[model samples]
Target: MHTQVAIIGAGPAGLLLSQLLQGAGIDCVVLERHDRAYVESRIRAGILEQITVDLLARVGVDARMRREGLPHDGFNLAVDGSTFRIDMTGLTAGSKVMVYGQTEVTHDLIEACLERNTPLVFEAQDVALHDIESDRPFVTFTKDGQARRLDCDFIAGCDGFHGVSRRSIPEERLAAFERVYPFGWLGILADVPPCGEELTYSNHERGFALASMRSPTRSRYYVQCGLDERLEDWPDERIWDELATRLGPEAASHMTRGPSIEKSIAPLRSFVCETMRHGRLFLAGDAAHIVPPTGAKGLNLAASDVAILSDALIRWYGEGEACGLDGYARRALARVWKAERFSWWFTGLTHRFPDMDSFARKMQLAELDYIRGSRAAQTTLAENYVGLPLA
Candidate 1:
């Protein structure tokens, strides 16, 4: 098969890119290693930044989101037992975030592509890139016991961190930076109303806890746990009790407890590749960078990457312009670093480092105190949390 662009991964990043390129009259195809059911069933972050929401709207895939997604203007940051709300909408001049699941966005984008009869090949195995440094690049993979090849003018490595796209690049040609947090987040999904209207982040001597939701009736909550903790260690009663204790009296009073339908532990990490593009192969989303879920930046950051890539591709295809394509890596790296900074800083502020000395703990408290007492600091937090503009 031959195409203008061969996109790897059927996640939101790849699917959204396919929709954007197809709308711009550029032909592209998406290849996925997993089937549709597996992709949609994977639970992920749900917070949508303004840029992501707008892109989904522009692509005509946000009808359900706009109708069902919760719009949160501010969230509570709890220190010990005290809670304070940061008015993101007020601080940022009416900019707020939408609470919507990444899975739903992926599902919507997939449906949009399928409805238009765009090519989306799922269950593709052993996907590999060839001759990426040359003007013409192609991909090879197996489908149902048969080998196949896709020749394309450009290749989009939209696959996640473990995907083959990044590995295809030579080691000496790439620089990778990563930091793995000492603790993991233990989360549970339950069928119950959320504790309140907006999400809440907490800092207690026990650790960090978060109260988030996928919908009005389905709450997603997380509490910090040991790096070696397992789901078996946290029962539904224990989870709710810990969440209530960490979230404080105000939230605990109104918190509705229920049976957990799903539970898991997610390790936290911040990783970024030095460059996001090589020759005709451009990387987007998790393939390029990953942020800890602290600032709710992972999925939104992916959307920004896709936005930059889509615009670059549109410019190249529509007006025969190469500047945008040539500058993709630089533009993406700038924003990637900023998000890394924010996620890293937030993680430090809200969690008790196991190795933190008394002095360092004081410093952390001092920083949070400054943020709570200073509107300037709150504004900065709001700006980063709501997301910076796409490069």
Candidate 2:
């Protein structure tokens, strides 16, 4: 089989790219190792920047999101028991964020693909890229116990961190940067209303905690935990108690406690692979970079990557312009690194380091204090939180 672009992974990045390219009359095929059920059910980042929301709308997948997704003009940051709001809309000239689950976005994109009769193959195993450094790139995989090969002009590695895309590039061609935090986030999802109208990032002496939601009626909460902590050690009751204590009395007053429907511990890490593109093969989303969730840049950065890539691909096919494609890595990495900086800074400010002495702890508090009092600092946070502009 042959297509213009052979995309690996039916995740949001690949699916969105397919939609964008198809809209421009460019054909592509999507391959996923997991079934549709698995891809759509995966719980992930729930915040959407304006850029992502606009792209969803551009692809005609925003009907359900428009009806159900919550939009917030700002969010809260708490130090110990005191809380303050960063007015993102005001600071960034009316920019805001959408509170929508990544799962829903994936489901919507998949439905759009199926409705449009796009070639999206699930359960594709052993997917591998070949001749990526050449213009005639192709992909090989197996489906239903039969081997298959797909010849294409380009390949998109959206299969995520563990996928075969990044490894396909020779080690000498890449530079990797990573930092694994000493703690993980022990999160719980319950059928209850959120404690506040907007999301909250709290820094207490105990640890860091986050108050977020999937919808108006489904609350998602997380507290910092030791890397070695086990699920068996944190029951619903214990998790709620920790949340109440760390979030302080004001948020706890409105907080609702209930049985958790989902629980897990996710370790925090900041990772970035330089040069997101190599020859005819390009990497987007988790395949190229990962940011700590503190600033909610993960999915949004992916959206921007594909948006940039789709434009480049469209121009290449339509106008015979390869400039965008040639500059894809440089443009995408510019935004990626800025986001990495923000997520790293935000994580350091809100989380308790294992080796933090009194002075380090005091420095964190002092920085938060400065942010609370300085409009310039808040504006910087609001601009990044709302998503930076495309390069």
Candidate 3:
């Protein structure tokens, strides 16, 4: 197969790129290792930054989201049983986040692609990207155990962190930055109703906990755990007990035990590749960078990448201009680093550090307190939460 662009991975980045490119009258093919069910069912981030919501609306993928997604004016920070709300709307002039799961967004995009007859190949395996330095870079893969190759003018390495796309570039030409936190989040999804109107981040001596929800009937929560903590070690009672302590006794009545749809431990980390493009191959989404879930920036960042990349490809194909393509990496990195810093700051504030002295702990608390009381601090958090307007 030959095309103008060959996009690896069917995640948010690849699918959204295909949609955007199609809108601009550009041709592209997408390859996915997972089946439709697996890709749509994988639960991930839930918060959509304001910029992300606007982009999705512009791309005609906001109907169901507008119907089902919850819009929150702000969030709460709880410490020592005292909860303080940051009014994002008041700070950002009506900007607010949409609470919709990454899975839902992926499903919507994939469905939209199918409806529009976009080219997407599922269950493609052994995907190998090659010849990035040449104008005719390509990807080789297997479909139903049959070998095939896709020749393209450019390759989008949107296959994510563990995929072969990132590693395809020679190590000597790549620079990496990474920071792994000492803790991980044990996240759970239950059928119970949510305890709060908006999400809450709690800081306690025991650990950090997050209270989030998908819908009125579905609640999602997470608790800080050791990196190697086992799922078997956390029974239903134990999970609820810890949640009660961290979220406080006020929310206990709304918490009801239900079928656990998902359970996994996600280690916190901040990672960025020095460059997002190597000749004809361009990296996007998790393939290029990762941020901890504290700031809810992961999926939003991926969407932002696709928005920028699609515009660059449009410029290249429509006007025969490569300048946009050439500067893609630099433009993306600026926003990536900003998000990395914000995620790290939020994570550091909520999670306990063994190295933190009494003074450090007090300082952290004071900062949180100040953020709750000060309009300037709230505006800073609101801007970061809603995302710095996409470059």
Per-residue alpha-carbon lDDT of candidate 1 for residues 199-259, written as tens digits (9 for 90 to 100) = 9999888899999999989999999999898788888999999999999999999899999
Task: Give lDDT: candidate 2, residue 303.
Answer: 97
What TM-score, computed on C-alpha atoms, does each candidate reach?
Answer: 0.99, 0.99, 0.98
- Higher-TM-score candidate of 2 and 3: 2
For 66-177, candidate 3 gives per-residue lDDT tens digits of 9999999989888855778888888999889999989899999999999999999999998998889998788999999999999999999899999888898999889999
The alpha-carbon lDDT assigned to residue 223 of candidate 3 equals 94
Candidate 1 off by > 4 Å: none
lDDT of 1 at 38: 96
Model 3 misplaced regions, further than 4 Å: none
Ranking by TM-score: 2, 1, 3
Which of the predicted structures, 1 or 2, would earn the higher lDDT when compared with the native? 2
| Poorest lDDT segment (10 consecutive residues) of candidate 3 | 248-257
Ranking by lDDT: 2, 1, 3
lDDT measured at residue 341 in model 3 versus the true structure, 0 to 100: 95
Give the clash count for each candidate.
Answer: 0, 0, 0
Q: Write one digit per residue (lDDT tens) for candidate 2, span 75-104.
A: 999999799999999999999999999999
